[model samples]
Target: MNSPLSPIDFEDKRLKIKFKLEKRLQKELQALTKDPPTGVKVDAESIYRNLSEWIVDIDGAPESLYEGEKFKLMFKFGSRYPFDSPQVMFIGENIPLHPHVYSNGHICLSILTDDWSPALSVQSVCLSVVSMLSSCKEKKRPPDNSFYVKTCSKNPKKTRWWYHGK
Candidate 1:
């Protein structure tokens, strides 16, 4: 016979998971601080205020179509964290004018969806977003951006999007 989990045991398990998540988030912060990817800037205040949410500022590559532009990315990590991808989106007034980005800040990136992996870190995500912007040859929005933005879920991660690149 098997016994049900006691309240004490359940609470202890919950705390252990919480501790692990906090430690993991802190480790990532330290790594980002020690050696951040090019063009990636984390809002230190956000990290201190709440480990669950982060605000990152990224600059457009000098020779890209978005040159001289700065954009903000907000990442919201749930309890699952590394086991699950963060809810990442472009935020603030300067959202990028790219086909993969909705005006409302929702992004259609594979790694944030079907391709997410526990091995991926915050730095890698920043680098990926930068690389995507740097490779854009045209300045345009997706044809369905208007409809999608209106109908999309409040949580961008829940939306189904297509990926055109590897």
Candidate 2:
């Protein structure tokens, strides 16, 4: 019969996994710092404070409705990052008034939920968010915003969103 790992073994395995996760995150951080997509900005402080969490700011595209406005995006990564998508949401006092964004900052982007791919990077996600805003025909919150914000789980990843015509 197979035996379970002892306490020491389990701890060692955890540390090893953590190390690997950090390594990957570090690589991403370097790349992001060196070259971030247009309109997306992140600080060394936020990314360094916790490798598992990052706060990125994006400016509304010049010709977009949200032009001259700024938005904060929060990304929280778990140990299985890269293998699993990070939890990303708009945060701060001003959440963009977008059709796909809830008042509470929950986003209904497909890649953040069911369509996630390990190949996607933090930079790419930020770029996607920028694109989402740039493509907006009108500035409005999601139709179900009120109900979803009041009843939804604090962790957006828990929600099963139906992404329609993004």
Candidate 3:
């Protein structure tokens, strides 16, 4: 008969998953460097050092409400990436003033939550964000931005976002 796995065994398994994730992320980083998606710039070194985190720069699309503005997105990945979605949020001082983007940088995008799919890649997410920004008709923060910012967790992923509208 076999005994139950110990806590140490779980830790070891987690470490192995992390290692695999690192390698996969490295490949993604290399691909991004070679042919980056439009409006997105990623720091390969930062990703290499810490495969679980990435900081990306996004240029606002021309003629869009956010034209001439720049924003930074922080992505935090777990060992179950590809199977799980990355915790992405706008960082830095210039968070976009969009109905879907909160004052605190928590983006209420369905793709990042309930609609997430393992098939989605970092580049795809960037494009989706760009598309979301481009489709906005007005430049304004969410109605409950202040309240959400004050009460939400530091990690946007922890919040249960209620996505509504287009």
Candidate 4:
């Protein structure tokens, strides 16, 4: 039998990256389901290498403005992955606008960028987002949240999100 570790005949780097990401995602999913967060349900999962997108469905919040709501969020992982942070956003048309979330569903969180470390996992990110949402007291959004969509760009591997508080 051929060794499973042998590389497959693929020329596209993106394909190779996708394979790795999918493999990691599968393991992560298994582990997550084996020990899911309290009151949270995962509805779907998919990977898109070309677009660098990872789609996840979450049903209900343990705390926050989104309680009792089912939402779909997108995470865009960069080449650096664990070393750097992934870009997370909300999808769909009917999401409630929050201070930390932009109009296009992009989220502004410290851990997803500046505070990211390899020690963190996908579960941590999800939990953090949940906690952030849960803590919201006002239904309105941030003052300058609209500018993020215009200023933010997809991570290109080298860019690092600033972690220090302003």
What lDDT score goes with residue 148 in model 3?
Answer: 90
The TM-score that candidate 2 achieves is 0.93
Error of 1 at 115 (Å): 0.8
lDDT of 3 by residue, 1-166 (tens): 9989899998999899887878778888888889998788998877788778899999999989888799999999976897899999999999999999998888999999889998887888988999999999989998888999889999877888787767
lDDT order, best first, reads: 2, 1, 3, 4
State the TM-score for model 1: 0.95
Tens-digit lDDT track of model 4 for 1-166: 7654434444466687767766776666666667877654453343423335656666546555677776677777677665667777778865556777667676768877667787787777788777777777887766665665567664422334443453
What would the per-residue lDDT of candidate 2 be over residues 17-120, giving only the tens digit for each residue?
A: 99988988899988988888788888977678789989998999899898999999999998898889999999999999999999999888999978899899
Steric collisions counted per model: 0, 0, 0, 3
Score every model by TM-score: 0.95, 0.93, 0.89, 0.69
Worst 10 residues of 2 by lDDT: 40-49
lDDT of 4 at 110: 80
Which parts of model 2 have CA positions greater than 4 angstroms off? 1-6
Per-residue lDDT of model 1, residues 37-110, tens digit only: 77888877669779999988999988888888999999999999899999999999999999888899988889
Query: If both were scored by TM-score, which would come out higher, candidate 2 or candidate 4?
Result: 2
Q: CA lDDT of 20 in candidate 2?
A: 89
Quantify all predictions' global Cα lDDT against the true fold: 0.89, 0.91, 0.88, 0.65
Worst 10 residues of 1 by lDDT: 157-166
Candidate that would win on lDDT? 2
